[model samples]
Target: MDRKLQRSWMMYDWANSAFATTIMAAVFPIFYNSVAANNLSEGTATSYYSFTQSVAVLIVATMAPVLGAIADYSGAKMKFLRFFAFMGMAGSVLLFTVNEGDYLLASILFILASVGFSGGNVFYDAFLPHVAKNEEMDRISTKAYAFGYIGGGILLAINLVMIMKYDWFGFPSSKEATQVAFVTVGIWWFIFSIPLFKNLKEKKVGDPTEKRDKSYIAIGFSRIGETFKTLKYYKQLLIFIIAFWMFSDGISTIIRMATFYGSTIGIGTNDLIAALLITQFVGIPCTLFFSKLAKWISAKKALTLALAVYVVIVILGYFMTSALHFYLLAVCVGTVQGGAQALSRSIFARMIPHNKHAEFFGFYGITSKFAAIIGPAVFGITAGLTGNSRLGILSLIVFFIIGIVLLQLVNIEKGEREAKALEDPREFVKVEVK
Candidate 1:
């Protein structure tokens, strides 16, 4: 079971999640609005930040499948993972240079850093099937989410204190502390990633005997084309991906837009932030609890239960009336968010052709990004038309509903059997290159 190897892979989650917390979620948006966009209105600053993030996401989502196909060809996952991780870390450190009236520079670095973070995760996810056996997938995946919660939560907690009590940290103001927080994310990410690079090795799946003459770039596209044509052989897996896309969109929309919705509706910023922090800490234990729950019941049932909870949460969100209500919703989200996502990853890992993890997880990444845009767009449109955020929040019910319906159609056992039947995994990448 290679406990050391599994832990090393999980540590990468702990490492990079600091970027998710301090840089992406908690500290940076506030810093960007106040310091980077010093002369701009708050609305304008937020708009610019959103635009920059969208740019980063577009680039990564476009590149993911090709990169994944190429990595699968020659045990290149580790190399690619290292390169993108460096990009993310470098961007985080460079954010320290941002000062008042430097929104352009801050935006550029944010785009680069986030691109790196998202790009690196494609390969990091590719390691899942290699690190753990079939029976261990749920435990390993759920625990990784738990590790992310604890690690990211700790750093964010420290950064919050640093900003709140800037004088105690010997900084001139909160801005200086915020800039330093960016550097801390970079250092923390790099230091924790060492264990992964040192301990885990990418298992080679490419065929040396079956040779091809095309450049990797061309071959990457070729591989994807072949994957598309042959996807019918993996029908259950395709159904699962569709289901995942729909539900994950709902989850991402809630995560990305919740604070803004809360702010728009008159909830205090401090209460919103504190409530979110509770989600992080509560997520740690609850995510781990799902691992045991999955073992007790089954991944599919556990995930179905989680999605059912999300439905209730959204309905409750429609009627939410106070800061206290928001806090309760945050707790509800914290309880199921990690479990649903963790189980999704593990379930996908179990279903795909073993040799094509990198290639397929790439698609997983892209679907997630694209689906992410839909919920927010729908929410925005609904809110705009109705002049109420409640209806906007309620609109998310459609995503979860469709996702659960499609999820029930996926035959996981048949999918696993189909995946196991593929022996010569390079049928398209090598011998059939014509």
Candidate 2:
């Protein structure tokens, strides 16, 4: 791809991250608990939040792979991206209207936004091979993540300012001003996505001879079935997928529940926002640094290092009794969060057949969504049963340990070789035609 197109594609990271920052990381949950669920008891509010997020994951997990397969078959990646982006943005903007004592409405909007956010990522990951070469993918993926942290941090910082100085914004209260911040996230997501839509070319569909004989829906199910059966053939890729599933479960749970956990433990709203802001900016440089580290050490080893950091952070979080400790833990998490996730994407990209990028990335999406379900459900259950949120937080350590054990077993080089061999014949045929 040309430099302009590559940059345009990366900008989608900048565009969509505002949703993750304002809605997911900083504002929505806090506002929902304090205002939307003002009539509900504390336990009920927490349970509702957990249930809403889990439901979104369940819906996306079932649909994402099929959607991805269809997009690949029809060469409709950008079209699907636009559709889901609109859904997410509309859902985000709806949050602006959610006032106190509107718990049901708020929950529904959040579920819509969460679905949009998670679903959009499937197409976003599909664009990787189009924008960068094999050697450059790790760096490009990491840079996109770094940009995401910066973009998310910048928006969150502005929202924090609005919340802290509600009178300046002409809002009646901080809560009301926070509610308006959701609209900004929606607008930001829509406006930034324009460059990607304008500049990035959709992947060209293969000739009819290369196209699958079945209908897209039929091919989708068959591909999924084949993927499961073929799992035994791709030992290294399967092992790595399991490892990613394990660690990502822990990571997703932490992202979803951290703010709520802090609120429950007496951490002030300002403190929670500040801690997340710290993570956002801190993640930028660390993401870039990990890209460099991958050049020296393998991507898998670099991921292992990040997981080790996660173990330490989760362990420390378990012992956190004060706001200061929470702030410290947030910083630690920010340092590794973007880097680990970026490397994970690049590592998987290296292992998958290039022609089937979107199809395989669909499976990646499914695994991530499913993994999300387990950790949060476990966290919610443990928190409810024990009445100690710290214990729930601490349980994440098991995920990291198991993920690392599984990761160590994956043969990265072997998987890359296998993927290359599968694509080499097709590439040679293309060259002959040219």
Candidate 3:
């Protein structure tokens, strides 16, 4: 394995995670509420934020797979990654100009930034199979998640301090500090990303001698059609994707809506923020521990164990009535969040052909975004009908249960064998038109 290349790949996670933490998770929502939506009620501000999030996810989910196919056909994975990264960075930098009553501008920039973040990740994930050998996938993936935790945590802590000590920085208020933090995130993301662009290379796909006249875009659409028609032959992989979609939806719902739920149950904003920080820092060691655990017990079993824990957490969430309970739930989620996700990526990496990683991981990205839709939608519907957030939290358990059931049916070894059998992996399977 090329250690330097592996390190470079991991650094991209470290780089982009600042956007995850500082922009998406912490500073931006609060800034949008206080500054951008100054003319609106708190509830209205939150609704606008949710609207922006949904729009961004919708755009990326629709684009990921097509772009992935195009990247594979054109050998332009790096080019796509660069374009998205710049889009995200420019959006983040532009956020510094947002002021009171600028909700429209804020939402637009956020959507662009989010599209960049989510879109860039499609290519980043595609590089995994290229950068790490089959045996090394677990370790490399977990290490990247760990780096994300550490890097994101450090920057978030700094941003927090800057907000709290705005006076020391000659800022009149926390709002100014928050705006500066947005600019800082853009700089941090861009600087750390330089290594990946400099060091990592996209693996070529398809036979060089097999020439076709199809334009890259045309081939991209054709590949998507081919992939859909051939799904029947790859039963295990298809089942795994379904199971992953369900459980990942549950996970994403919990992450996205946890704080809001906590507030409804009487947890203070400070407590909620602190609890999330705990999840971030706690995830660092736990993610690395899962790497070792996967090596000892296999990725499938480790993931199963994580999903089982999630079932317990959601059930407990139904009964949680105190700040301490919320904190405990946060810890439980922290223990498995990074580990489960990292292992899932590695396991999927091992089951797919290296040549089609870009295309397949594009599907992976779409499933992830789709999950973002499912969990939240279910939770919202349940909460609206029952008038209780606990029941809404409990509804997520259904996703975990169904995911576990489907995951049990997947034969990882068999799937790996089938995927490995394809010499021209880009073919996936032969397409037949009726």
Candidate 4:
């Protein structure tokens, strides 16, 4: 492995996770609720938050594959990554403009930031197969997730302190501190992303025998059509996607809505932020544990264990009525959040043809993004209808249950073999990563 390149790739996680932690999980939801959407009812605020998140992901889901295909056709994966990173960074920085009763502005910026985050992630994930050998995929992927936890956690801790001690920072109120934190996330994200741009090279894409029009846009669409035609040939990979789509939706909803849900039920901001901190700090060690467990048991089994934990967490969430229950639930979530997501990335990387990593990972991104749709939309609908958040939380179990059952039908090794069989013979011989 190229150690520098690998480290560079991992640093992108460190950079972007600030968006995940400070903006997505900890500070912004609270800000959006108490300030931006203060005009709305508690239930409506929660629904709007989830709905905005769903819309952001839905936009990315529609474009992921096409953008990926264009990148592959033009050998411009890094360029696409840069564009989205900037878009997300700009959105993060602009979040400082959101003031009380600025729900519309908040929604627009949040969606833009999310699209940038999710879009950049598609290209970042595609780099996995190019940088790591098949045997090293789990370790590398987990390491990236571990770095994300530590980096995101560290920044969130600082942001928490700033919010707590606003006077020391010369801010008159916690609200000002939070607005500053949004800007801080943008700076942190951009600073950390530099290494990936500097060190990691975009692998050449588009096979020698493949034909395409002069326009990359046309070729991108053609490539997607061809990929669709071949989907049935990779049965295990397809099965894994179906499984991942369901369970990942459940996980994403929990992360995006937990604080809002807690707040809606009368949890204090202090306790909610503290619980997020617990999840972040506790996740550091737990994520590493899953990486080791993957080596011992296999990535698939480790991921299965993580998903099982999620199912348990969702069940517990339904019964949560106090800070203690919320705290315990956060701890449970921390144990599996990174592990499940990282192992899924590695396992999928192993199953796909490396030459088409961007395209396949685009499909991976779409499944995840679409899953974002189902879970949050369901939560929003349930909450809107019943006027209770507990039902919304409990409803996620169906996704996890369906995911676990479908996961059992997938055979990772067989998927990898099938993918390899489809690769160009000469290229396969030149770099026999397996």
lDDT of all the models against the reference?
A: 0.90, 0.85, 0.89, 0.89
Task: Give the TM-score of each candidate.
Answer: 0.96, 0.93, 0.96, 0.92
Give every collision pair in model 1: none
Q: Which residue runs does candidate 1 get wrong by more than 4 Å?
A: 209-212, 423-434
lDDT of 4 by residue, 15-106 (tens): 99999999987788879999999999988987798679878988999989988988877788999999999999999999999999999899
Ranking by TM-score: 1, 3, 2, 4
> How many steric clashes between backbone atoms does each model show?
0, 0, 0, 0
Which candidate leads the pack in lDDT? 1
Tens digit of per-residue lDDT, candidate 3, span 266-328: 999888888888999999999999999999998889999999999999999999999999899
Ten-residue stretch with the least lDDT total in model 1: 425-434
Candidate 1 vs candidate 2: the TM-score winner is 1
Candidate 2, residue 152: lDDT: 77
The residue-by-residue lDDT of candidate 2 on 1-434, one tens digit each, is 48888788888898899988988877787788899999999889978987887788888888888888778767888888888888999999999889889999999999998888888889989889889988988889999998888877888888878987989989999988887899889988998889898987775666756845688889877766655655555567788999999999999888877877888889987888888888899899999999999888978899999999999988888888899999899889988999899999998988887667777898899888888888987887888799988899988999999999999998888888777665543343232210
